[model samples]
Target: MNEELLKMLNAINSKKEEAKKLVMEDKIEEAKTAKDELIKLQNKFDIAKDLFDQQEKSKDEEIKNKVKKLTVEDEEKKGHNAFVNVFTAGVLKKAVNEEDVKIYNQMTEADPTEGVSDGGLTVPQDIRTQVKELRRSLDALEPFINVEPVTTLSGSRVIEVNADQVPFDNVDEAAQFPDVDTPKFKNISYKVVKKGGILKVTRELLQDSAENILSYLTNWIGKKARVTRNFLILNELDSSFGGDKTKTLNNFDSFKDIFNVVLDPSIAISSSVLTNQDGFNWLDKQKDSDGKYILQPNPVNATQKLLFGRYPVAVVSNKVLKSAVEGAPEAPTGYKYPFYMGDLKEAITIFDRESLSIEFSNEAGDLWGKDLTGAKVRERLDIKTIDTEAVVKGEVSVTV
Candidate 1:
């Protein structure tokens, strides 16, 4: 099936090139014929790919059944033991004991393609799911932004409306319709980039119970993934609107102006405030004329803080959203804390290409000699800002 899909894809590419050549040669009819064939081939490829995915899912179910049988046979052991056994065997290049051998044999019998040579053993589905959940839970910014799951490596999305443009006009009945501003559509393209790191494990840690090992690995990977994604997202927001859209707010009244005067009401309605701990500290110190703190607890979610009792404030740690250090001696506190207010879901989009993939190795470098193994984990995704006008960036400075 994979071979057939590749062949079809190649044919489509060839047909596309042929059509381009025909168009260049002024043969419109020939180009049209080639394009029709190309479309047909694309449809066939889609069908085949869907079928292939179904078959792969079916195989995964079968593998799960085999794992279930193994668990039943060893009622005292945890379900994660099977994964531990596989990991041990892959790293050691051999089974450690009779039970390890039995478990490894069952896994290979269930899925022959999971050998160490085949791009390392794909982490078990259950563990992968847990890791994914942990990552999402730990990431502070992901829940509020637009997240899109995509299967392809690269693609483009059409933005239907220009955020800054007013494309509508009012007209009287029976009057000649005046030409309103035409809606300008924009295309945002994304390509997934691989982000990964290696986790070095000591021999003693690997010797722990299966559940403990799994817990430790998942926690580490989850936090690392969260930090990596947060860094990328914050950087994207800064680069997109940090230039002309940035504002400087000193007092409580100026901060209020972000929503009241800086941003359009349409955008302000759906906007939230994002700031570092330093900026939040500044806001926390502000009081109204009645001596009430401007930042109050959110009415709906008491645990969350709200700015002006309207917009929720998301406070990122100063470590994650670092302040810029000033060069001059007279600069207040020598740092500028970043503050962002906007509809983040409209401002940024995250294209998730695939889930977390982990591979273990004992032979990497001098691991065998030092009795240390490395677990390499990788994630693929892309981040893009679709609407710059939806967000306002601010930098706040205060004297010590």
Candidate 2:
């Protein structure tokens, strides 16, 4: 509502400035002409006396005058900064990784042992200081050092589905392998059409130099890189979290933006494991008579270290669905929903066979972006992937 008014006010302000400049430079004739234009504009604006008067009042006066803020938003806006442009029209596209958790704590029939201490990796402060000093001393030769910045991800259980009891030599190769009945793989495959996952990155656990170093690191890379990607993080094989100097070793306990998740595999799995162990440090060891390791596992609750950039979401909006049902006499006689808005980016769109629809890459480059507002926008990535199977037959159905 204030858009039109703002345009007028900005023009008035520009003209006033121009008039002041012209008069100061001794351009009397030009200044007079500009002043005349300003006067005319002011006169035109004066017709809306109620709006102009309302805008002239200070915020405090306006607030005291009105008890209900929302009901009198026009008055409230007048009291607030008029130059603000809230970018509410921006679109959100997020990706996430879905993981199937295997029960690692399941009893595999092992013997109970009276153990006071399990050899855990605990680097002493003095040793850490010594190593840090050594690094500082060798700063000149640091670049030449062939340090291994390797990551070993763990606990990614085989991707499985309950639909059919299909045997697999390897779940990773299932897509390439033939179905039991199809003898030879007849190019029959299921592309990841919809995926819903989330990584909630948080900054809830940091202290001292740890905090200082973390702060420095975040300032260097966090907002700058602003890069996102798909990866299987293989850094869980060692106690030292992967040697990515750009990232953290212990955890993501320094960021406050929760709900934004890091869709990395290693970080997700390792974080999940550590989360399960947090409550166990409080438990005292015990003995069991049945000769079984009756480890009283603590109540495990993970805060889902929010780095999962976004709660990956996928939604079959009207636009998307219309595109999905294109070309057929029936509008999507059937639709398979494997994801919600939270399921986006689980499986990247290897191919978008749907025409006039857009798909975005990590760099924010969009394909088929110009026609995004049309009815061809699909809600399902699967429907967007196959050209032969899915077709758009009808023209866009939009109502004004």
Candidate 3:
């Protein structure tokens, strides 16, 4: 636009200079003709230029109006889902990165599902990086999860999710509980994930249930404990068994079946053997009952205790259970599996008849280590390394 305007201005200025020269030479008739021609050309140019300027100004005004319309200030009163897409994207990156690292690092002996590891990090890193790039396009958006405002369009006001095709039920209370930016996604819905600031999973958190689970997991499991998980949907089951893998007393399924049977009945469990020591006196350490050992007799009061007297119960599907119980036990009613007596201490599961099951085998696929037990999750946004004393003793640092 400026270039074209300059061209026109220069044309008029040059013609004016020529006309002045024609007058200075005292060539009156020639000067009049030259002046008249210049005036006519200038008038012709103005006619076309007026329309062009009008169009240009109109375009400028239109763009300015659009800029005003999209202002964050304008959207503030509207519950505009300014950040939904970008937020969801960020959420997605965090979830996938965590999942990939977690599932990949799981006990390889148990999974036997090996893939090539990339510098100790999996190839999923590539996918997360790509998603983050797409997320960058949303930088202009204000980070938001908008709630629909009540409007006179109907009556009073209405609260609705503004995102199209995304689950816009309500503000994910989980999105900001236990302090903002705290880990809350897994507790909110173990299956549901955040992506592009959108709900990208099949589940939603039941506020009360999620809160309780989060609390329990936080209390039992240390906040710093690294939990690894792999979500598997049991679409079909091979519920048949007869040979070496069958549920006879000495077989693998038999042991798993027994443990499953005992654990399924309750959410919690207790082992009197661990919690109650008749001859040994753990209580004796607190005989004076001061400082760290401040309580005597029952250190665990009616409400609080750091120790889990027994192994915690876990949830598994009925199909897995039925498959485990495919073969019947041949033992007498009073008889028990040798594992129940804690016989295999070094490399086998120790299954006690009363209340505890010790998972000891390196190859044993125990569900206990497979999940976060519904703890809230937050990504560190940076790589971390295992720096235990063993590494120090070896004069090495195991980094990831």
Candidate 4:
């Protein structure tokens, strides 16, 4: 548009020059015609300039609207941050601004289902998501087992096929059907239980920034929650296995038999080996007759180790999965470590209530006298073994 206007203005200027030349040359009629053409060109230029100005104005308005939308989004983010700061101050039982008290109350009183009146405050959604991600880093057993989210405090899941059964018999056409054996079912019941602990914070730590305070709290809660769940699942796995089913890995051949002979072919296809750090260390040192290491790098995941070039091996901390020494005095001592191999997802199920609640107290125990604050975090969940045959509990012992 601007270019068009520039061209029109240049044409008008030329016509004016032509008109002036004609008048100087005494061409009166030609000069009048040139003057009329110059006036018409000026009018067209004026119209085009107005339209260009309107277009520029429209573009400016569009830019302003976008800026205003971005400002609103930034303000919303600032508001949420302010709320989190106020809530964090309240949790630490520190002094909060009077104007921001409403924000704190909104967080506490917004959800009656969370039992806020009883002093329990639900962790903010964003913080919860962060904590969950952190918890996964510390988890060992939870990721492998089947997790079922449940709303009820207590419930039961019925298993129609507990074990492999015989297939139906063939029948002739138009012949009477033969009677079949009644199917058996096993009911696995679970009741959610509370697992929680108190984390004490020094007065100095409470005075830190809200982000730092939340980070400390989340790290503590995530680790504790993961450890509690891992302990419960491991306990259930131990209880499900019978003495007859549990075996000792005396040599490399014995370890291979766990997948080839002990576990069912169907279960072995999807099985993984689980052991503590101590057991893994022993297995990592094993060698074949050709002097090659038995533990190979997993083809699918290079970070993980595979046994028999097939099953993935999962290693947990020795502190979590402890080792036991068995044998009489003066005899060769056996450092027995757990070597559980099987399809863990099909073996156990965790009924998760999916609720984590936190409460704060300044007067709990010696916190008040010490000028410290205590935050109590609680988690609810239940674990049960669905199939005992899905896993083989083997003890890998290092004898000396």
lDDT of 1 by residue, 84-165 (tens): 7666565556644555445544543435444444335556556666776787784367777889999999999998775356
Candidate 3 residue-wise lDDT at 168: 28
| Native RMSD of candidate 2 (Å) | 32.4
Off by over 4 Å in 1: 1-79, 95-111, 163-182, 328-332, 363-366
Predictions in order: lDDT? 0.79, 0.28, 0.29, 0.79
Candidate 3 clashes between residue pairs 3 or more apart in a chain or in different chains: 83-144, 87-197, 88-195, 88-196, 88-197, 89-196, 89-197, 150-157, 150-158, 340-351
lDDT tens string, model 2, 159-259? 23321334444446446754453222223233323222211212221122333433332332222111110111011111122123122212223111111
**For model 3, how does the per-residue alpha-carbon lDDT over 112-154 read when each residue is reduced to its tens digit?**
2222221111212322333223422321110111112221212
Any idea what lDDT model 2 has? 0.28
Predicted structure 3: lDDT: 0.29
Q: Looking at model 4, which ten-residue stretch has the lowest summed lDDT?
A: 108-117
The true-versus-predicted C-alpha distance at residue 57 of model 2, in Å, is 69
Error of 1 at 114 (Å): 4.0
The order of the candidates by TM-score, greatest first, is 4, 1, 3, 2
Error of 1 at 349 (Å): 1.3
Highest TM-score: give the candidate number: 4
Segments of candidate 4 deviating more than 4 angstroms? 1-118, 166-180, 242-244, 327-332
